[model samples]
Target: MAVDLPGGVFRMGSDTHYPEERPSHRVRVGAFSIDETAVTNTDFAAFVADTGHVTVAEQPLDPAQFPDAPPENLVPGSMVFTPTRGPVDLRHLSQWWRWKPGACWRHPRGPRSSIEGLEDHPVVHVAHADALAYAAWAGAALPTEAEWEYASRGGLDGATYTWGDEPRPGGRIMANTWDGPDFPWRSTGESGFLRTAPVGSFPPNGYGLHDMAGNVWEWTDDWWTSRHPDDATSACCAPDDPRGGDLEASYDPAQPQFRVGRKVIKGGSHLCADSYCLRYRPAARRPQPVDTGMSHVGFRCVRRPATVEGTP
Candidate 1:
């Protein structure tokens, strides 16, 4: 399902979180359409069977990318889930995210797993390349930071959420997120998902889009560059629609160069909670290597319609 965002002007970014999101700005975007839900296993499976597509994680890792790392690690694989037994230590996400060989979208848990009864669930363990390929197969494209934030707002400009500023209205859980004691245990089922719940299980935003804020982070076409641009302050819109920096540079000057050009992932996932990595809001963003995938990350597609002479 697709929602046509007759895209126009909207304020972008927030001061409440990362420095990259500071100094909210105004942006003008041509009208475009976007998927109402993240792409599901069923959608991608067809693409896979038809094209014989193989994901980057399914291919051998380039040793030069991790020269000092173990040569044994240079095998086909992606992030594997390791349930936390106790309080999380933010310093080490690797404790729960292991690079398991044979782990891909079809086998989310690892070589031993399969999508099985979860065909309707949003496809996880997909890297940016995998997602782009699927988008191409569907004849749709990914959204820009501006376009994504605009659609995510559900036409409620600067409202703090897709539904409203309040995280919960009238004590009802509007989206899937951690509700129990932080990380390690007790998922109170506030959003009714211990991991990723089926897409559209919760109420849709005002624009009728599902899973805009949580469930899994959706991949954007934009690479992580110069944070999100200061759209308002700049007098003119960037010619490049998806204004990202170099695929070889980081927004943060201090970060390593090899991590540059990583694609930005939006809409924090269920694993994110107050205990650590609290990136569950629309404005929250993170970068994943173009070839990295995880159980908590997925993607949605956006259709960029060509400008017509008479539509307003």
Candidate 2:
């Protein structure tokens, strides 16, 4: 089911959170319809079966693109989150993420793993191209960063979470996030799933949209910008349906030679924990390479009402 959002102006970003989310701004978005839940494995399977679409994680890597990569690592695969045995440095993300060969959407854990019982779970290991192809097949479009963040807020203006200021209101888990201590492996099981939970498993937001704060990070159409543009001086000057930064500006300076532009991904995943990555909020955002997919990353689609010739 798709929920119709009566779009309007809203305050976007956070003034007291991650550096990237600073400089909170106001954005105007048009009315649109978004999926009530994240795109599930069953939904993506139908698209693949009908279109014979091949996800980026399933295709072999081009040697020319990664000349310095090892020959053995040139095989098709995607990044998978493997929790460490004990306490480890949280700064290094490689401690829990591995590039397992053949780790596509179908084989989430690797070549041997299958999605037999996870049909309703949100599909993971989907790169930007894969998500775009699926959206195209479904006759929908990926939401822009502004649209995504707006919908995620679910009518809540400046609340810290999709639900409210408290992450776990009344001692109840609202989304699927890592409910554990500082250690990456330990899980409090409050969210009910170690990895990706079934779509709509958690309570929906004010807009009746599920998994808006957690479950799996979703792909957005906008390129990643370090921070949002400053708020317009007046309502008449507010940006409408802003697209975000350019491809050149989205690249990571540390990997200057990679030449891959990143898109803005919203909604933290099951790996998000307060002790570590406290990003399971409506204003929280992350950057993802267009060509890379991970076990904790997935996406949903949205559709905007057609505008009349002379309508604003």
Candidate 3:
């Protein structure tokens, strides 16, 4: 199902959170429709069955693209999160994230794992191209970063969470974020999931959108910039449905040799924790490489008013 949102102006970033979301500013988006929840395993299976489409994670790596990669590591695989046995250095994410062979959407954990009973969970291990392909097949498009943040705010401008100002209003868990304070090691299992949860497992946002804060990180159409541009000079000057940085600026400076572009990804996943990654909020944003897919990344689609119902 999809929700028809009558978009309007809202605060787009968070100065209170990570630096990437600084310069909290107002932005406007045109009316659009967005999927109520992330695309699920059942949905992706149908698209694959109909189009015989192949996901990036299922394709062998190009040696030229990974000249320094070991020969054995060139096979198809995806990054999977493995909880550490005990406390480890939180600064190094390598402690818990591993490159698991055969860990595509079909096999979330690895070749040994399957999505047999997880058809309703958000599909993971999907790269930006895979998401775009599915959107095209479904006669939809990926949401722009502006449109996504506007929809996620759900009329609560500048609220910390999609629901309200409080993280857990009235002591009720609003979204499916990491359960315990200890991350990458111990899980209290309070959220009822250590990974992706079923769509709509938690309460919907004020906009009738489900999983807007967590469950899985969602791909956006905007290229990534280190931080949001300065706020518009005035309300009338606020950029309408603003786009993000240019392709050249989206490349990671730390790994310039790869020349890979990145896009903005919103909605922190189930792995997000208060102690580690406190990003399960509407304003939080992250940059993800366009060619990479991980076990916690998935996407939903959007449709502008100008788009025909059954046409992209």
Candidate 4:
């Protein structure tokens, strides 16, 4: 199910925090339709059964891509998040992320983990290619960065969240996120889930869209680029199924070392924390390698919604 977005220009980033969100600028998008929620496991299952689709993580690495890595190291794989029983150093995120063989959307959390009861959960462990495949099968397409942000803004102008500027008004947790001590303390499910929740489990945005800001990092069709106002410019052209400009040698002002070559991924997930993640806001984004997929990554779809003439 998709909703027609009578697209118009909107401020796409924030300047309060996160350099990538700085110099928030105006972007005009043509009218388009977007999926009401992130792609669900049930949706993916149908695609697989119909096309006998095999995700990149389900197939051994093509020797062409892993030329430097040892042939023995090449294997069908995905990234896995190793939960810490107690507080551990948060400085290095790599300590928690590991490459696991045979890990994909079907085997999210790795070989032992299963989606048995999560048929409705947003499909994770999905890389760029996996999302593309499903979108093609659905006769839908991935939302460009602009479309995703525009939709996520939910008709709210310059608002930090899809709902509004205040993430938790009256101290009520809205989206799915790590509420407890994060690495050390257990998730209290204060937001209703410790990990990935079923799509639409939380409150929908003004657009009646669910899981737009949390649950998992949703992928966008746009490429990497700068958040610096000086470097940012109006999308020169508005083309159907538009993709953002190429990445520049820009630094996410907040963390310059984390440079901006990686493509932007939106919708922070359960792993997000005020003490660590600080990425629950709509403008907040992270660069992701197009080839990598993990337990926290998922995606939604978009199109010029079907409606009366001049109705997007």
Predicted structure with the largest lDDT when compared to the true one? 3
- The clash tally of candidate 2 reads 0
- Best of the candidates, TM-score: 2
lDDT (Cα, tens digit) per residue for candidate 4, span 1-312: 988889986777787888877777766788888999888898899999999998878988777755688987798888887776677788878777888987888889778878899999999888888898898888888888878888888999888788887869778777888786665346666777778889888889999989887789999877767553442344764334345556554234465643434567998988888788878778888878777789899998876544578755
The global Cα lDDT (0 to 1) of model 4 is 0.80
After aligning candidate 1 to the native by TM-score, how far in Å is the CA of 281 from where it should be?
A: 1.8
lDDT of 1 by residue, 1-312 (tens): 898878777777787777767657777777788898999999889999999999877889788877887878788888876777776676777767777899988998889989888788899988888998999999998887777888888888887777888878998887787776556445666666777888898889888999898788889887786456555445666333446567656444556545535777888887776666557666777877776788888999998876689885
| TM-score ranking from best candidate downward | 2, 3, 1, 4
Of 3 and 4, which scores higher on TM-score?
A: 3
TM-score of 1: 0.90
Give Cα distance to truth, residue 190, candidate 2, Å: 2.5
**Distance from true position, residue 55, model 2, in Å?**
0.6
Candidate 3 per-residue C-alpha lDDT over 61-108 given as tens digits, one digit per residue, 9 for 90 to 100:
999988998999999999999999999989898999999989999999
The 10 consecutive residues of candidate 4 with the worst lDDT sum are 231-240
lDDT of each: 0.79, 0.92, 0.93, 0.80
Arranged by lDDT with the best first, the candidates are 3, 2, 4, 1
| Candidate with the larger lDDT of 3 and 4 | 3
lDDT of 1 at 85: 70
